[model samples]
Target: MIEYQTSSFSQDEIRQAAQIQIQELPQGFLSSLGEKPLALIFEHVATSQFGVMVIAKESSNNRVIGYVFGATDTGQLYKDFLIRRTFQAIRYFLPKLLSWDRITKAIETLFYPARKQQKRQDQEECKAELLDLAVVQDYHGKGIAQHLFGEFVEQLREKGVGCFDIPTTAGLDRAHRFYEKMGAIKVGSVIVHEDRPTYIYRYIIQTRKHG
Candidate 1:
């Protein structure tokens, strides 16, 4: 049977679980974060600071298989991330000169809600933002994403969530498809900021039709 967990652990636990080893440069927003590991800080930000839900699954053997993290707009952590990154990039990051401008533009695009939903804005309510989601490579195509997402939605309702958000772009083909499969419809988007061209997607969460 697939088991789900939402317990909290310290930063060290996140690092060990994510299995991230590279010591990324302290540049841009990352730089402002100082010596803390990125993965742990991110987990903390989502669960503790943002009041986001954590959906994770483990096997019968008790090994982690997948997880998704998200938070409400009250945190506004994304905006703060941008400001910190700007300073870090200028000071320490060695970004690809060509890709730098484009990346910045994409960040800006994710800020504003897609204009397509302007008419429905009055009736809709704000929900948590899905900040991160991932499954172990070996566990791919096993309905783990769907399982975790289902549980997360239930948890969201318990938390009084009315809706949720996801950040994606047309360029991120895989992510876009995943959201589509989750029954998320696009509400807004913006062109990535550069000659190379890119776009960001903003998708809203739809509650269970029967529930």
Candidate 2:
């Protein structure tokens, strides 16, 4: 049996689970968020308003087997995160910025801030996004991901969210199929980095009509 609950796991435990389950970081906006810092970021997101962080544990031994992180308003959460964790972000990013490639990329991004405007604009109607979801390999085919996602959607809807924006890499057929199975529609695609393209999907919640 498995139990689901709001994230009460420590940063290290969450990071370790992520390390095992999430093999690749989506390249583009999330390319810079490395493994070590990702855990810290999750910590922040878990506590933000409209934030959803849930963990699943194996009842037999009380071990975390899967987790999901989502937000009703990713844009606002990030803004607040920056404001609240200014020094922390600096502490984490300063060393990475030391590399010549990192410095060059930062400079280029600063000058080309308008490139991602379309993607940003699309978020105007998207009320939520599944920022991250992962389940341990050993637990595959056990319906854990399905349960976690179902709960996530339910929680977001309770918060008045009607639409969700989900992005996955172009080559991820299995993932694309999974979201489609869950009622997501292919909305659009955008190039995140220089050449990497990501497909954006939308899932709209149908509201009951009152006579």
Could you say which candidate leads in lDDT? 2
Residues 168-195 of candidate 2: C-alpha lDDT, one tens digit per residue: 7788788898889888898887664454
Error of 1 at 52 (Å): 1.9
Question: What is the C-alpha lDDT profile of model 1 across 98-174, one tens digit per residue?
Answer: 36554564454454444323533664645466655667777778887787777667767667676776655445677
lDDT of each: 0.54, 0.71
Tell me how far the alpha carbon of residue 92 in candidate 2 is from the true structure, in angstroms, after superposition: 2.2
Model 2 C-alpha lDDT versus the unseen true structure = 0.71
**How many angstroms is residue 190 displaced in model 2 relative to the true structure, after the best TM-score fit?**
1.7
Off by over 4 Å in 1: 10-13, 20-36, 55-62, 78-127, 191-211
Q: What's the TM for model 2?
A: 0.80
- lDDT at 83, model 2: 82
